[model samples]
Target: MRRGENLRSEDYMLIDPFINGVAEFHDRHRDMRLDVDNMSYEELLALEERMGNVSTGLSEETIMKSMQQRKYFSIAEESPSSLEPCCICREEYVTGDDIGTLDCGHDFHTNCIKQWLTQKNLCPICKMTGLGT
Candidate 1:
């Protein structure tokens, strides 16, 4: 949560979707053996268009802004009957643990959900868009 703080392996694991997506994209294009250095202007434009169609291009700044907009709370601040473990880590939320409540109404650890949104702008549970298009 602070500058220069070390993140756990779980944090990296949360971003596996994006990493795997890129790998899969490369795998799909392996046979083409496209050479970027030799691409013409038109070919570059066409490639950019195709990539735009494939991904939303969500960036780190966009993800941080979205995360900041969400409401943060502790488990003790909510009713006991409504308490639930974070779906990302499958861990119970302690009273003092920081939680983020997304617009979709799902709650998760602030760090856990932030990492997820950075890779994909969808709620981990419902696949609903969590950030503005």
Candidate 2:
């Protein structure tokens, strides 16, 4: 707050959170260890999957299975309207383009939505949980 001011933990975090986050991230990753010499191939794959789920939010299969995909169709045929681009990538959707439509009705390109789901289990636009939906 001032020159030679005492910093509480909260204050230090507020002032220098990036450095603290780096240290915390390093500490967290450093703790995940593998006994490669002893583990079998299957064990290694399982460990990798576990680590993947930890590093990312969900597995690809889970995302693919839980999220619904449909061919993009224009709503303009029903009424006057404009097309909106995919929220994540801001790319305009063409008819028949594979779209990931969440239960909340938010539409995104399939790849964009998959990438988003890999890191987060909720809808980017509505914050609805994928599993719940």
Candidate 3:
């Protein structure tokens, strides 16, 4: 129905999002390696299903299955050590806050930058760069 979608079958529909989400997940984990290669095909399938659910908030699993699916994992957990408040709102990033980080390693809450990106894509505080950059 969409640009990259087909109405041929249900499995095809699932495949597209699965592959796309896996691609995103791979980009998000390029530097990390999981025990994926070691997992049985059934286990891998289960993990992929869980990943799909996690990405879209369809399921209520607090932690993702991939956490246990990988080895030598390097996921980006919320940084507790960097307690610095967002440069825009001057508010701390809470447990469920969405965040975006700059190439310069500066971080900001998602809402602030999203509003700013709508106007233009640059950091509100430093002005070094923005979403478009």
Q: Pick the candidate with the highest TM-score.
A: 2
- Ranking of models by TM-score: 2, 1, 3
lDDT of 3 by residue, 21-96 (tens): 5533437666675688789999999988877842212111221211121112223774656577877788766666
RMSD of each: 23.4, 13.0, 22.9
lDDT of candidate model 3 versus the reference: 0.54
Which of the two candidates, 2 or 3, achieves a greater lDDT against the reference?
2
Instruction: Estimate TM-scores for all models.
Output: 0.46, 0.51, 0.34
- CA shift of 98, model 1, Å: 1.9
At residue 51, candidate 2 shows an lDDT of: 69
Colliding residue pairs in candidate 3: 34-70, 34-71, 35-71, 121-130, 122-130
TM-score of 2: 0.51
Per-residue error at 1 for model 1, in Å? 77
- How many backbone collisions does model 2 have? 0
- 42-109 in candidate 1: lDDT tens per residue? 99999998878555436767666665444444545578557667889988777567777666877788
